[model samples]
Target: MGFIETFGIVFILEAADAMIKAADVELVGYENVASGYISVLVRGDVSACMAAVEAGVRAVENMGAKVYSSIVIPSPHPDLLKITQIYNIDNLLP
Candidate 1:
């Protein structure tokens, strides 16, 4: 699991896009915590997740936006998966 948070929808989108293109990963949807703060999530192997997060941060920085936070969890706990499932986009797809 991995995520990158930034201000504004555009910055988040750019981060997500760069993340997906940088590695083999699945988009886990996003979280909007209000006040224009948003986070984009992704899931993949440790190396891939790390690469994705790095790319995301770089992308946002290149756009002149600051990355609020970022993380790459190589082995997430089962409880964390429960929460992440809520943000999973598979349910939204047909």
Candidate 2:
């Protein structure tokens, strides 16, 4: 999985687009942390995920936007996925 943290909706959209275009990756979802802090999540093979994240960071920087954070998790634990529900949120409903 890969994550990109930005400060605005425009940045998030641009970053996400660049990331996906850079590699074969899927956008899991996004989270709005409030106060203009937003996080985008993506999932794929380790290499692709890494490349996507790097591309996203570059996209934001090239656009003169700030990237608060970027992370690539090669192999997240199944239990962690269960807790985060990154790839699927429908399961979270009771």
Candidate 3:
């Protein structure tokens, strides 16, 4: 990759890392997908981690960086384990 591409990847990755740590979210790991984009995995209470993720997004937004798309919260990895054991029939059955 050229300098610009490398910098963009690093910048996004670093931003994601800093955001997670600053929000007190437990980061599982991350991989740089491309310039200004990365996939992040974090572990913690689902809702709590979500809140933290939201905080992280806000921080990025505060920086006035353009997000290519909306930030996403994945189904599992962090709080999926907890959700499975919640014992909520509404969630389980229908």
TM-score of each: 0.90, 0.87, 0.49
Q: RMSD in angstroms, all models?
A: 3.6, 3.7, 10.2
What is the per-residue lDDT of model 3 for residues 57-91, given as tens digits with 9 covering 90 to 100? Answer: 55555666544433434443444546433433233
- Best of the candidates, TM-score: 1
Q: Write the per-residue lDDT of candidate 1 for residues 1-94, one digit (tens) a residue.
A: 8989999999999999999999998887898989999999888888999999999999999999999899987877766655766864543221
State which candidate, 1 or 3, has the greater lDDT.
1
Cα lDDT, all candidates: 0.87, 0.86, 0.45
Going through the candidates in the order shown, the clash numbers are 0, 0, 0
Backbone clashes counted, model 3: 0
Pairs that clash in candidate 1? none
List the candidate 2 regions with Cα displacement exceeding 4 Å: 86-94
Global CA lDDT computed for model 2: 0.86
Model 2 over residues 35-88: C-alpha lDDT tens digits? Answer: 989999888888999999999999999999999999997767666656567546
Q: What lDDT does candidate 3 reach at residue 76?
A: 39
lDDT winner between 1 and 2, please give it: 1
| Model 1 C-alpha lDDT versus the unseen true structure | 0.87
